[model samples]
Target: MAEPITLTAPNNTSYSQPTGLFINNEFVAAKSGETIETVNPFDESLIAKVAAAGSEDVDVAVAAARAAFKNPAWRGLSAADRGALLYKLSELCERDKHILATIDAWDNGKPYQVALDEDLAETAAVFKYYGGWADKIYGQIIETSDAKLAYTRHEPIAEQTPLSVLYLGTLIKEAGFPPGVVNIINGYGRTAGAALAEHLGVDKIAFTGSTTTGKAIMRAASVNLKNITLETGGKSPLIVFDDADLDQAVKWSYVGIMGGMGQVCTSTSRIYVQDTIYDKFLDRFKEYTVENTTSGSQFDEKTTHGPQISKTQQEKILGYVESAKSEGGRLLLGGKPGAEKGYFVEPTIFADTKNHMKAVREEIFGPFVVIQSFSSDEDAIEKANDTEYGLGAAVFSRDIVRAHKAAAAIEAGMVWVNSSQDSHFGIPFGGYKQSGIGRELGQYALSAYTQVKAVHAATCSGAHASPYRSGIISRNSSLDRGSILQAGDHVSPSKRPGAKA
Candidate 1:
């Protein structure tokens, strides 16, 4: 058993924090005695020492998961029972929301309220939504010869990874999943994460992190031909048309780039305003941003914004601010450190930026955004699609037709009209281009965990010329269903359908 460390937040919230590598439904120490220091990003204080898993620990964890995959207790479980386990896990998460939120605020430098009210809530909803889909996963019938019955069967691909550190394991432990059904480990992405990606025992990998790391995992998984679903980097765009409700657009634009200190992967840091309203929109946007943003300790209720995840992140963001300045991007709002001690950064906006500049093209994961003006819809679409990333985008306009047109034209997996970053657990979430691979949430996420196999069996009375009709000259169906007459002279297929154009 792992020891629990007691912690007290600035707000007087006390909780027992777990710091272990969870495997086979139990918490254990790293084989190398390695530990990663969990730091409180709010004030650079040490939170606790969490066990650091390496290649050896990952190998052990994967072995356990592989064993569980073959275990009758798990493999023989009914689909509804699997879903029930997920539902119970979701409830466990909701029950411990405060503890989880406090951990997030302390470790991730996010506002406690946002972590508690939004992030934790959304996570619970996600598990519940997927739980509802456990029994609904099905494959369709394929058209083949009348002599053989053919269909597809889906099976669990591999291990169930932890959503994040600490609290998730507690929930899994409390949820009563069979031993080895889930595993959690804590270590640097370069070590433990790389091992999981490259481990031959792992059949599927679902990762969400930096684009560089995602690419590295892609390369690693190629060795085993594992199924990989990555939700990676984004320098997404949000366009504000001339006829849009300026106040609404300004509000959403602020939320798009400035929310979460712009650490979100889908943060719309690139804003293109129609030239007819560009100046006015900028004016209103600045006022709204300044009025709304207040960077301070994550535990402070009055603080609408929190610090970056670390001092390194803070310096990286500040460096980007300087790069924007050097590139001649107009600094429209706050551009300095947010607090004296904490890793806080004031929300900054740069106007008059060009598309070709690094300040405009790169994914600067910070509370900094750049603005540009476009003369027409064609110009807006062109500028928005300029980035190599295409995760998320949004369009704002009063004209419904124009809004939808721009939304469709923007090359992103998820596009919103007259809104920004609104996500639903029941809707698919992922990206296109270099942004990522497959979708994560909704029914589509099942594809990540399940593998399909086509099963065919012969039902013919006796041996025929061939099991498949290779002699058929026609590329279309040999005969139409519900009709006595054959559709084509090529009958070697014998009622079998052909490939469609």
Candidate 2:
């Protein structure tokens, strides 16, 4: 078995960090006993070495999960019972929010305050929100003729291993979930992640990462034709109209690209301001950056800005800065390291940038943003929708009608009016085009883990050689005599589902 490593917080509080692969409700060493070093990004110092998973370890985890899926301890639970377990987990998360926030602050390089106030709060909310939906997982009953019954059932697509945080495993165990129902392993994406994606025993996969890696997972999952959901890369746009509240827009724009150190997939790295207030916006934005932002250790109470997740990430952001300079993008403010040590980068901005520039077209995934001016609403919409990514965009305007109009025109999966980056637990979150394949959060997320099954019971035999069995209705369902379908029913037009209307 692997042992837990202890660490002290800046506030002088101590906690044990579990340094093992959590499988079968226990923390155990990897098959090879290899370890991954967990570093504190605030100081670039060693924290502890956690057990690392290889392909062989993945096999063991998968086997355990398969057994648990069959075991009555997991399979026999009612939906409400399962939800109760999740609710207990949420309560545990709430109780330990401070410690969880501290772990993310040290390991992920986010400010402890924000992690506590925003990240941990949201984490607990997510679990509680989804837990509430467990008992409400309902299907529709179709209208069938007398002596006939037809309906559909939304069945669980997942029965085995669910992936999550190294800390979450402890929470799951504490919440009284069955062993192997949820497994977490620490390892690089190549070995353990790939093995899980390719495993035949796993029926589905939901991944949150870069578009490149999402594509790789899709390919590996092809071995079993596993159902997959990918939340991938983005270079989303945030537009500011001339009539917008200038201060609000400026402050939100800062939060847009600076939250999570701009590591968010839906970060609004591209901004379009109306030509009328372009210069003023930039001046105010620069002033706001100077006054409102701070860079330091995540443990420090004064710190607002934190370091990049790793040395590699810091270097990559720096490289993108150089690329911005070379591509004729004018630097407005902050284009270097914020401090002499750690993986800190200054909150950078590139103004007067062209749409074709790498700084605008690509997802830098750092605390960097490019600002541009638009002469007209048409121009703004066109510029915002020009990127291959359609993850998210924001529109700010005093006129709600105009704001909504512009929001509708933007070719993105989600759009915000008078706000940016802030999301609710009840909202569906995801992207379009290359940004992702499906949605998460709210009712949409429940669907991602569900499979629909249609049921047909013929109490009366020879009912016109069975309707809907041929996947086609020769006549209009409403016009047919004794048909149970009501008027205005949406009919499947043809056998070829992909055919355009």
* Best model per lDDT: 2
Q: For each candidate, what is the lDDT?
A: 0.85, 0.86
Displacement of the residue 7 alpha carbon in candidate 2, Å? 2.0
- Tens digits of per-residue lDDT, candidate 1, 135-209, equal 988977876665666789887880111224566887887887888899988888888988988999988988988
The alpha-carbon deviation from the true structure for residue 500 of candidate 1, after best TM-score superposition, in angstroms, is 34
User: Clashing pairs in model 2?
Assistant: none
Clash list (residue pairs), candidate 1: none
Please state every model's RMSD to the true fold in angstroms: 6.5, 6.9
| Model 1 CA deviation exceeding 4 Å by range | 158-164, 460-465, 470-501
